[model samples]
Target: LGNTIVFPYSYKSSYKSNLLGSSTSPIQDVNMEEEFELKDGDVVTEVVDGIPTIIFFDQVHKYIERRMAKTIIMKLLGRSIGFNVLLKKITSLWCPRSPIQLMDLENDYYLIRFNSEDDYNKVVFGGPWVIFGQYLTVRLWSKDFSTSQSKVDTQLVWVRLPGLPEGFYSDFLIRAIGQLLGQVVKLDAHTNSARKGRFARLVVLIDLKKPLMSKIKINGRIQRIKYKSLPIICFSVWHVWT
Candidate 1:
């Protein structure tokens, strides 16, 4: 393996096989010494009990994915917060050797995975994890883990262009917003039915070069910007569990 990705929620294995013997999956035992010839860099599988078990012999670390959690759902509730910052905080506490993978189901809700069950326990049961002072609810994931990673998109900050003047085309709107709110990585426009067909009520999705506060200037006037998540919690200490 290039580098071992450690997950606290991983399964422990026995000498007879590299997989957990008590796992719910059906597996059959095999006699590696007599069944077949093994080498340093080959992959083989045998039914143990009723479940299929794979063994990579001396190089199991390189070929097997042992650092991920299946059926281990970690639902989170800090979407109105910065994704990168939140990810950094959680990773710093868990400190997994492999790149941590997370999926943004929608809004601030996310599905996070750890390298081991211990890390999951630490985060879920470690008590009162407050990120940016917003209480984080951690729990076991119940959904399928095979969701394609491509569903992940940029964590966008939605800005309400309340007073956009008439004739504000896409180019001009993007330029105007960029000048006020900082650089825009990606810009998109949407119309709401609640606006009653008024162009001034359009919403713009902005992927900022950096995160910003809740206020910005538009047409030289300070305007409060609404985002997908604007929690009422105040900033507080960031607790770590290492």
Candidate 2:
């Protein structure tokens, strides 16, 4: 935990909502798992449709613990039919169209891997500091994804640290931008100054709000791609202050 910042598990949702229906958020127990990289102090929250699915004690709601959220969602789904009934729903996390591919345990499950770095950059805010840019992502995870190991069949957020040096940039940025799309989104994307010799432009997005569109973050540098749109918001922010 020295150079590696300790993002605690407190950020994990304390409750969950059955997003399937009820017109409100549900309550759930944060299913702690070995895969949880979140430490014991990291501030986190789980919410849906504006209502926090779990109680939180963080400075702000930013990254959406993809695995945690997925678990909560799974609980929600399971609640509908009771936890004992896996039925064919276990595969929904893999193929949405034909998630029900099998009933037995062999093809009965799937893995949850969140590595859609390209997808996150395209839709919401974008970032990458290297001049030519070899690796531009910070964190990526998946919910019911396809992996080589036994399919987790649950949400899992993975980290993809930027190619930049430590402590220069990403200080003010959320750990995982894509995970916290909707409910509320904010970021403080920044880059290591070109003169710093860090040779990396840092983009830290400080998320301070709630869900925008599922897991989209909104901040000054957010893309108009959504990258393109950031300028518009910054322009507006500048005008209001002036």
Candidate 3:
């Protein structure tokens, strides 16, 4: 779908991952060390349900989305190409995806959804929602896979954004990895904790920001990670049953 223009950016060099799923949210410290602040690769790992924890990234990266705004959605059938520049430049905000949107539930609580009757009377703007069974779920899912009496039903849920300010994603290229498949892929990170020495551990159940929807898996786990600049919220590993 992104056939219009190609960016002069390289995906590999601009990012790097760690071999261990360690805490990546760089601990804020003024006198800690410059090497720790600017150095890339912060690993975050955790254990859950007797299974090795997975690594995921919920970075509040101040992403500057520069794109050639299209005037029309059509093929090159000798049609006049209208020039469209970027519109609605929002700064210091949140960025959602074209599918599901990040929303504010109330106070410090936020949820994701495609649609919601519970929010029927609630005033919501610039968000995403969809129909799910009898109720609307933020992590929207498709119809049940079972039509038989013995079959079971399931759906993929949209992932939730971090506790970062919703304003950080104000109209950014929004994308939601539902809770059902919260981790779009797997990767690794290099982490060092007082309990665990500096080492690389394979990270599982990992997902990236919208731009990095591509999944990576190997050796029953993944290593190396490039995270976005986001405020720290949680430091536990998340596992989404595949």
Q: Best candidate per lDDT, number?
A: 1
Whole-structure CA lDDT of model 1: 0.42
RMSD per candidate (Å) reads: 15.8, 17.9, 23.3
lDDT of 1 by residue, 66-163 (tens): 33343133334433655455566777765655433454444445555453456554554444455766545443443233334322212223345554
Give the clash total for candidate 1: 24
Give the RMSD in angstroms, all C-alphas superposed, for model 1: 15.8
TM-score of each: 0.29, 0.19, 0.16
lDDT for 162 (candidate 2): 34
Query: What's the residue-level lDDT of 241 in candidate 3?
Result: 19
Error of 2 at 124 (Å): 3.9
Ranking by TM-score: 1, 2, 3
lDDT of each: 0.42, 0.27, 0.22
Residue-wise lDDT of candidate 2 within 1-242, one digit each (tens)? 00100011112111122222123211222122223245556655667898887553442233445333331111121112322233223322122221111111122221122223333342233322111212211222333333342322221122222333344344334334433432113333333222343323323332313122212224443322132122112422221110
Q: Which wins on lDDT, candidate 2 or candidate 3?
A: 2
Q: What would the per-residue lDDT of candidate 3 be over residues 148-220, giving only the tens digit for each residue?
A: 3121122122233333223223222111221223433211221212122332222122232222332323234
Q: What is the C-alpha local distance difference test score of candidate 3?
A: 0.22
- Model 2 error, position 146 (Å): 28
Top TM-score: which candidate number? 1
